[model samples]
Target: MSTSSNRQMKLAAYVMAGPVSGHHGGWRYPSAQHDILDVRFYQNIGRLLEDGKFDMMFVPDIQALPRRLGDSLASQLTHGALGALRLDPMLVLTAIAASTQRLGVAATISTSYFAPFHIARSLATLDHLSAGRAAWNIVTSFQDAEARNFGLKEQLSRDERYDRADEFVEVACKLWDSWHDDALMWDRATPQFADPSRVAPIDHHGRWFDVEGPLNVSRPPQGRPVFVQAGASERGKDFAAKWAEVIFVTHSSLASAQAFYQDIKERARSFGRDPDQVNVLLGMVPVVGETESIAKDKQALLDDLCDPEAGLSTLSYQLDVDLSPFPQDQVLPDLEVGGVQGHYREVAELTRKQNLSLREIGKRYGVGPLRDFNGTGGEVAGRMQEWFDARACDGFMVQMPYLPGGIEDFVRLVVPELQTRKVFRADYTGTTLREHLGLDRPAH
Candidate 1:
């Protein structure tokens, strides 16, 4: 890791292998790519991000379609809201790994739905395939729709889910450490395979799981895949502090970001971890243009194309409440929700501060995170540098307003400005995701 005086920003591309990103209207954008199902589309993305010197390309996933609002999938399907048509993230990331050399590939996996052995084996295999460029974004499946798909009637409560997740990750780490790094023996003259004594069973018995024996896969190249997380609630923050290496987060202002940054770092210190190793990345949508006015015009065009119902549908699924019955023009009422309490708090705070109606909030949410940095390439880089210098974030998770075009614009425009300022990498100096992010590899 670089010293405090010369720390560089870590950049990651937050993406989905689906029509929608954070913006519901993205797919309709004329310049956006439509062949999402093709593996070549993702391979091209991997190559583009690698060429841009991005640290990683992280893909978020959902297990089920959005059917929370009005008990129908029409709004999500018709408008291409997120989760309407999603592919398995791991499969898409595996394809990207085959085509790229240095770009890190991360896929979201839920601890609530999957067994520890399954996650450990899958990520171990990915680490080997990518040559140590794999990361796992940990999430406790928030939506009830996801729970139903896993043979449960509803999702677990917030605290309960985290409790299980804490155990879940523990078991996975144990499984990964079951085999010693030097266990393998490729020498044919010895006429022996891996040393049996060096590989032993991890007799783990916990409240959430009971797994015995070693993982079927060998130890990963990184020892363990780098941990990525985006938990914002009180319990969630504690979990991130304990386990997350690359922390993805969203905030409406610099002050909020700074507060979160400080809190998480302090929490990590309390957990006996080095704060520098916990990299906090703020989620940002950068709409680039040659001039500031052109950028505003581009953002306006995106907002105009948005379908309000689509945003409400996504919000409903996220909050686990049917927002369709509420009056659109009236102030949004506060309601206790079970899904993603942090998201609910953010949206609720926005409504209170702005006196925004349900209709206004929905429209804003559809456009994705608040576009706090939208201008010319130099202007956008200036804002990013300000945040990095102020310790508001270690970096930015570049969320695209549209696919290839949005990514292309940032790489062509803002990246050069950042490189010129020497605040971001001009070229990759490391091979693994851990190295790219300046994190220490975990010992087995």
Candidate 2:
């Protein structure tokens, strides 16, 4: 490690597949590769993350797609012009785990639809499979389609969802604790697989769920996988303060980022926790090229691929308001309110702040501008440093502009610059996500 980088911040990458481009039409770029459903795709991505010295590559999963796109899921599915497909992040993470040694793997699972025990076992097992390098991006499924898939007519109210999430995480912690660190004693001589007394059932009966007993997997090497949360509402902040080790935040401007960062850290302090214990990571969708002009040109080309129908469809699903009737070039007003509060509000704020027309805002969805970094390696690195210095965030969640190439560009060009500037690591100092984040490892 470089001495100069000791005081600098850290960074992580987040990879979602089929079409995880920051902009609506990102995946359509000639250079962008797909077939992410294949296990090898993730393995390759993982090896790149490990080679790049990234803290981790988080994969966010959602139980349902934007069924609200139209009367059927076909428009959303056919919106290939729009970048909006996601594979099951957990299964992909497992493939990644097998290919890398030290890179941490994190995946999102919704607390709204999943049982606490189920979450506990799956995450703990992942931590074990990855040898202590796993992170869980705790989330609540927001779409009504997701609710229906769980055999419900509608999603729970926001407050109720968060309430259930609180209890869900609480139960997960208990189950993780149920199997003490030394609970397993693989004594070949005595033929004892594990200490039965050490493993006890949680017997948790909460308002939202009833889970009993210990997780099938033993306590992971890191004790519990690193907890991550991303909600921007008031209740969401409180939840983050209580449980999140890494808080993924999205804001269009530096001012907004600083405000949210300070507010969440102060809230953590009020919770009797070290504010620094939670690493605030800003999500930045990066589009980079060898030269500034080349990068901008590439971005423009990618932007051209957007389908107005597709973009509006996505916006409808996200904002819960259909803009299809509105002219594609028209500007969106603050006419409707919907969805979770993190990035949606930021998108609205971006239009007002930049005096963007409705068409411009819709274009923004197709090729996101509310929160992204686009430039040559040097330019991109400088912007990241500025955000870090401003105390706007402790780190960044690198969102790929294109598969493989998007990630490859950052690693090959931006990573070196960042390392030379001593703002990012050139080698990993530890194996687990928590250790890499500089958090104290839990007592065994």
Candidate 3:
């Protein structure tokens, strides 16, 4: 395979601490582990990803259960839907960080419900504990169920949420910058603990938040944890352009992925940021096997195991619309949604392009996004190399169909092929997450 620019692909394992990662039927797989609450389960995953030389392990979080369909959680609970059960991503990532030495740990923490100081402190602590291998996935949660958990009647409008998020990040950056690198002084002769002149309060006053103070923790080893985001809306893209170092995105085709990649890079440049510094990672679901037929059978099995209602329920929650009212045989009508606009757009495109009914979409959604990388290791690696060469993405955020096994398969099969092709690293060369991504640490 012909190589692209000496730039190596950056791979991150998109994961969740729930039974379901992306595929609703994943937990039902015979080899899938159900011991999600066990830290060892996550640690094993960490070691597996590190063993494969993945750049990072990313964990996405949801604070509440799926209740958008008929205002009931029965379908979700019964089928073990995506959001049926979730643990705190930060805590899960910490466990992973403890077991793995080189793999970076990224945790999703919503800006909507958390104060700037709280998030800054938590991420800084994680960065320190992990010895600089830390990243924060910034999210402005769109679910009303999530808002309700924090005593709000409903979520703010999309624009409003983005506005708040912009300010929220501003405050967080200030807090993270509160402590200078030279603030800590352990001079035994002078008996001085820290240099007071080097440390100062942020004294940030914004429309959304007002915080006065320096972070209690010392400056993180990374200076600041790497910022990750998955915003596909126009406003969301702008926010990402301004702040996100790693951009996670989902696309159904190479053309779509290319469009987003170019658009985001342009947006980053417009924001006075180097486009190359912003890594755009496309979400990919890899169903691999020793042979193409075996891979097909594995995919078919996942499809057979899927509960359509579980997919619809999770979809409903994502779109903030009840799918139960829509006829299963009819095409989903275009409607203004208050939830994840990007996801809604993807679903709508699928319906329009294929003229698919709600039932058809549900079954497909339950199996997760249809991927081009479902074959033998060589085939999967070839397709990935194609995307990388085409500049469709900086790399991929691999979403597994099943837990440990799914990741285990890719690591064993595809990783070696990519390494041989010289499009991916054979080993980690950096300690900090920023260094892994080739991003410079922000100046305090």
Candidate 4:
């Protein structure tokens, strides 16, 4: 293997505490704690990532619970834990920030439901509170359960949501820029607070939203909390190309990942943006143990704990079609269902490509690799390296298979191996998330 330090590659971890991720049943594990409402658990996870020298921990949030119809709590209890039972991502980030230093905290807050001013202040405060170590995962949630709670009779279509998000982001950026570099002047003797000249109103008026004037807070330490966007639809890619500093994506194969990566970078270039400005990150789940065999054994323990029926229910919501309607051995129909985008298509594509049976698909649902690649230490690291070498991803956005245990093992086992191989870093040399990701901090 050629020994060259790949300084540009970045890595981040995702945390969703419960039985499993999108799959419904994994949380019932004795080791798994469904009560993610606990602040201490999240705080510990934050501490662990910092110790592991990981770039950041991104917490994905949904505005509402979507699966009450497909799978009741009984089904949810079996397969995975939904967002309804978890701590508000913002609160969790605050808890995590208080307990650690250096680890960047990023939370998903939807653009569809929130106003530009509200979103701007909340994220800016987090950036200031975390001392510039903050990021925002810009998402327009897909589930309709989110819409009802926000008082909408129906969910906005994906394209409309993206349109709103584009404007939301633009307004947010203008608001962040309202306060210039030296807006605050706390001269002890003089006591003239802020320079009024530096403060300017954005005066934004768009079709989706209208906001007037400067944000209540000043510009964050990193200028704007590192802009991260996650959506894999065509409209999503365009939005990401225009505004995203980091793009979170899902792909079943290396070819798919590379294709998506190349397309997005090309799109970014067409917009007169540096391709390097958009970091492509593949979402993956890692199951680790002392050895590959041990890891398999550990995964078996998790699998044994899984409820296949619950897994199916969760899959139903993700695929947005009731799997129970189809026979166990019947092939899935190639229906043109359009509401949900991104990961929904990804899951459907994987099932069709692999020709997986209903039972087979359910079994693998919340098991080991929830979204992307899954394996033991050596195998996982090898696959990760393959993606990196193929230019499929700039890094991996690791989603935990369980609570602290899932993330704990990867940090302890796989990280050391990857570091020794020189494929991953041994220490974090920078302070802010942008610095850690090797992106230049914007000056605005």
Off by over 4 Å in 1: 1-4
lDDT-sorted candidate list, best first = 1, 3, 2, 4
lDDT of 4 by residue, 1-444 (tens): 122355345778877643345333346545766556678878888988888888888987776554642445556544444543555788889888888888999888899998989989999999999888889999887767678898988778888998899889989889999999799999778876899999998888889877897998999888998888987778988989988988998777788788899999999999998888788988876766677677677667767776556556655655455567677665556655444466566656767888877676666665633433456667777778878878888888887767777777788777776787787778888788888877777778
CA lDDT, every model vs. true structure: 0.90, 0.80, 0.89, 0.75
Positional deviation of residue 329's Cα in model 2 after best superposition, in angstroms = 4.5
- Candidate 3, residues 1-444: lDDT per residue as tens digits? 223568889999988888788688889988999899899999999999999999899999877987888999898899999888899998998888889889999999999998989999999999999999999999998899999999999888889999999998888888888888988999999988999998889988888998998889889999899999988788889999999999998877788889888999999999999998899998888999999999999989988899889889888998888889999999999888888877887788789889989998888787876568789999999999999889999999999999999999999999999999999889888888888889989988
State TM-scores per candidate. 0.98, 0.94, 0.98, 0.92
Q: lDDT tens digits, residues 280-375, model 2?
A: 998888889899899988888877887656666666676655555666555666664456677578777877778776667766766665444779
Lowest lDDT sum, 10 consecutive residues, model 3, at 1-10
Flag regions of model 3 displaced more than 4 Å. 1-3
* Model 2: residue 246 alpha-carbon error in angstroms: 1.0
**lDDT accuracy of residue 254 in candidate 1:** 85
C-alpha positional error of residue 430 in candidate 1 after TM-score superposition, expressed in Å: 0.8
Error of 2 at 75 (Å): 3.8
Backbone clashes counted, model 2 = 9
Q: How accurate locally is residue 96 in candidate 3, as Cα lDDT from 0 to 100?
A: 85
